[model samples]
Target: MSAFSDSEIAGLKVARQSPLIILQPEFVVRAFTLNERLLVCNPNGRLDAEGALQHAYFSDFTDV
Candidate 1:
């Protein structure tokens, strides 16, 4: 018997859609999840902006 239902598999596929990059007036960021791990990035070409992306990605309260 299959461990996961078809609906659950479909949900997983939907959740794993291609990542997107978000550009804001103050920062640029891209984020996605694979398996159970969350991956995030920034393309602002600044150390602080990159750091902020990392911080937000790792923070426990981050919604995304």
Candidate 2:
């Protein structure tokens, strides 16, 4: 959740992981209470989804 900005999120990947393959942060996969069964994505103003689309990784399919 630290890197909440969707535009910046595309570049903010995890530096380390077990397998060490391109690991991105799971801002959307957050801890939820047992009562919460459905997954809801409600980014009020923190996430800039439009700008994220222009990111190099996502904009260019070959880059990934």
Candidate 3:
């Protein structure tokens, strides 16, 4: 699992999915595991608005 930000917010698999970009650089890898988001690092993490729009995955099955 690749993540834009390696912060605790997006450190684990869960965070990478909906990766929360506490910083700015982590707004690309991915997000959206429990919640809906978009990015590259979908380690079930939060995501940045700009990056979230990159992946845009709705669910576990509906990965966009």
Candidate 4:
């Protein structure tokens, strides 16, 4: 997947039919995984935003 800036948040639409893994330039590839939640990381395994998975899944299934 390509990298996106926070500024592009407006046009960003993630597909919920499948899971999405968004990695920061600092994290290791193996550092990303799905544990019933969204995981964001930096050079050190840090959490930028959690619950992203929830939002995507809900939005996909929602009427809105």
Q: Which candidate tops TM-score?
A: 2
Candidate 4 per-residue lDDT over residues 1-64, each given as its tens digit: 3446555775878866633344333232323333223443452453234444334333444553
**Superior by lDDT: candidate 3 or candidate 4:** 3
> For candidate 2, what's the RMSD?
19.1
Per-candidate TM equals 0.17, 0.22, 0.20, 0.16
Q: What C-alpha RMSD separates each model from the true structure?
A: 10.7, 19.1, 17.0, 17.3
lDDT tens digits, residue span 1-64, model 3: 3355556556556444533555633333333242444333765565666554454342333444
Error of 1 at 1 (Å): 9.3
lDDT string for model 1 (1-64, tens) is 3657866776664344442343232222322322113322543433454455455444554653
Q: How close is candidate 1 to the true structure, as a TM-score?
A: 0.17
Q: Which is the winner by lDDT between candidate 2 and candidate 3?
A: 3
Pitting candidate 1 against candidate 4, the one with the higher TM-score is 1
Point out the worst 10-residue segment of candidate 4 by lDDT: 28-37
* TM-score of candidate 3 to 2 decimals: 0.20
Residue 49 error, candidate 1, Å: 14
For model 3, how many clashes? Answer: 27
Residue lDDT tens for model 2, 1-64: 5546766878777865443232433322221221132233554533354544443435335443
Per lDDT, the best of the predicted structures is 3
Pairs with backbone N, CA or C atoms under 3 Å apart (clashes), candidate 4: none
